[model samples]
Target: MKAALMYGPNDIRVELTKKPDCPEDGLILKIMAVGLCGSDIRNLTSDSRKGNYPFIYGHEIVGCVDEIGPKQTKYKVGQRLFLFPGTYCMECDNCISGHSENCENEHVAKLAGTGGFAQYIAVGGEKIHYGGIYEIPDHVSYEAASLGEPMTSVFACLENAKIGYPDTLVIIGAGPIGDFMASIAKTRGAKRIIMVDLNAHRLEMAKQFGVDEIIVSKLDNPQFAIDEVLRLTGGKGADKVISATPANATQAQSLHMVKKGGLVVFFGGVPKGSMTELDTNLIHYNNIWIKGHFGASYDQSKRAFALACSDDFPADKFITHILPLDEINHGIELTKTGEAIKVVLHPWDESFYP
Candidate 1:
């Protein structure tokens, strides 16, 4: 087996390793594709020395069950699957309270081990199911399955905000995650969807998925964009404003763009100790709800995987790069630029090694 391991800042190398064997209650996957996530980049360059070196970083994954342990024979030798990389301790107070992702025993995940970057992984326990291992539908592309985590995170945000049909929606950051939120917003019947982002290319990428009404973030009159949003909503502002960008400005922008009694969501992760001040009046006067959604619930994995495998979202459109294991460094570099929407590592790509 071959995999890429992160040693330090801006460094990765391909190495040979023994294939992982399935645990008694687990399965083994032959990784097919994995998407580069913002967190991965953060881990690469985080100021903290907490990151585990010689680590595998990918988490957004799509692959197939190559084999299964005796107890997991229900999953066969050739099932296409998407993994829920989160593993929660079921005995924890939070898990006992049915808040698995919030399990008190589980410390925050700063780095992902056994990453999707490798050619194979031994999948197990709570890490494998809410319902069960998802069998990808024939119609779903590998790229869509790779989006399981990103879409699931967006779904968690929607749940937190309670966004519904006939609501006006404004999304900050037209990045891949933001665009995924827009896709879901439209699917949920949002009355009007306005997307805001700094990248024209990302806005253009959103169009590839058939979204319109994007506001470019680079303008002196950022308020003009908000004004257009207000105008689109008959001057009441949006019912829901989501900041899928990690920037503090994006979150602040969401506050200003939403109407009184509207929901403001931060669906993207801000680093540790990062802080921002908001006008307290908005909370008191407008009755606005400021909500932050972190990772997805372990209990939602089965449903998320099904949705990840569903035909509804054209998730394949999200993948912009697919490289072999040895070229994984290139994949990471591509994702570093705002331009590469999604980059997947294919350990099996023959060109990577030769």
Candidate 2:
């Protein structure tokens, strides 16, 4: 098997490696499509979540079952599956409370020396049952199924904010996360979906994804965008505001864009030591609700997969670039430069892509 091994920050090598054996009560998966995530780039640049050196670093995965171990009755050989990616210990308090995404031992599945970046990887260990694997529906394409992991986080944020029909939902970011948030909000009956970003190209792309309005923020003057949002919302502000970008200013602006008693979801995390100013008076007087969402639980992953399979979700539009495993480094670079919305990797055939 050939795997792309990351030896350290900014260092990755594609080399022949031994394939992993099927774990007891688990399934060995043949890599099909894996999407590059922002977190993966963070590891290569900031080294924030670099767990171990010489490790494979990919989590958004879609693969077919190649080998099924004994007692694995829930799945079979040749069955396509999408991974939840975050392995957890079911005995932890978080897992018992239905928040397995935050389980005490939660980590990328590569700690076991196998990851989606490889040709084949093993899944299902003693404590990996909570959200490790999900079978892809026949109607969903491999590219759409590979997006299951990141889409779960967007669904989780909406759940945290308790978004519902007829609400004016504002998403601050036009990247892949914001794209998913906009589509999900529109399908859930949001009356007016407003997407804000500094990138005009992304805002143009957002128009194709069902957003009611688009605001291209002025890089030097965010206030102009804030005023425009207020104007669109009739001076009351949006019913729900989601800051999906990590910019500190955007996080702060969410408070001003939300209506009285509205819910503002902080969907992205800024770098450590970075701080944003907040007006506590708004929360005290207008009763605003600020919610922070991190990861998605097992149940949320299932819901995201169902949504991806739906006919109206426009799942295919999410994939903007496709490359072979040998060119994963280029995919990662495209993601950082905002040149690609979502990049999918094909481990089997380097030359096949539609």
Candidate 3:
């Protein structure tokens, strides 16, 4: 087996490694495609997670069941599947309260050595069935199936914000995740979708995904963007404001872009120990809701899979570049440079298109 192992900040090596055996109560997957996520980029540079070193770091995964454990009756050999990377302790208060994404103890998929970056992986954790894996639909492309993980979190954000039709939705960041958020906003009843990004190319891409308006973030004057957003919303601000960028500036400005009594979703996260100041009076006087969302649960992952299968979702469009595992480093660089919307890696170098 071969895997891209992250040794430290900006250090990842593709090395031949011992293959993991199929767990007696779990399964083994021959990885087909894996998508690079923003979190993966952060992990590559500097991640504050507990299991943070000398591990593989891919979560958006699609693979074929190469081996199924004796007790794993829910899946079988040769089945295409998308594996959820979140491991939650069912005994946690968050899990018992149905907020398992916030489990007191969470082990990301990569921490267990089953990161999708590898040619093969073994999944056998106790919480695997809870929100850790799903059968990829027959018609879905491997690239599209790999998106189930990120799309699940996007769905979670919308669920938390309760965004729907007729609401003006403002999304800060026109990256792949932001594009996914725009794609489903109209379906959720968003009357007008406003997308913001510093990149002209990404903002242009957002236009194709049904964005009603586009605001280019200004480097010289950050408040200029917020003023433009307010003007676009008729001085009332957007009904739902979502910060999909990890910039502390975007997160802080999200409060200023939402209408009174509206909701603000802090979808993207900044670095650990980072802090931003917001107007306390603004939130108190406007009665606005500030929500934070992270990984998705089992049911949300299922819904995301359904969304991937829908004709309107256009999951394929999200995958702008595909590369063999040998080019995985280049793929990661492309993602970081904003040169590709979604960069996918094929561990087997096989045909991945539908």
- lDDT tens string, model 3, 1-354? 989888887778988888998888788889999888888888877744555677877878889989988887777799888877776666777778887777777444333324778899887735455556678778778888887778889988887778897899999999999998988887788889999889988888778787989988898888988999999988999999999998889988899999999999888988878897888999999999988888776567678778886786887788889887777778778777778888888888845331
Which regions in candidate 1 have their CA more than 4 angstroms from the true location? 21-25, 47-51, 67-74, 89-98, 107-114, 125-132, 219-228, 231-234, 352-354
Better of 1 and 2 by lDDT: 2
Candidate 2 residue lDDT tens string, 255-301: 98999999888888787788888989987798999888888777887
On TM-score, the leading prediction is: 3
Q: Whole-model lDDT for model 2 versus the true structure? A: 0.82
Q: TM-score of every model?
A: 0.86, 0.89, 0.91
Rank by TM-score, descending?
3, 2, 1
At residue 208, candidate 3 shows an lDDT of: 76
Tens digits of per-residue lDDT, candidate 1, 1-82, equal 8887778877777898778877888888888877777778777666334656777777877788888888774678888877
Error (Å) of candidate 2 at residue 290 is 0.5
The alpha-carbon lDDT assigned to residue 7 of candidate 2 equals 83
Predicted structure 2, TM vs. truth: 0.89
Worst 10 residues of 1 by lDDT: 105-114
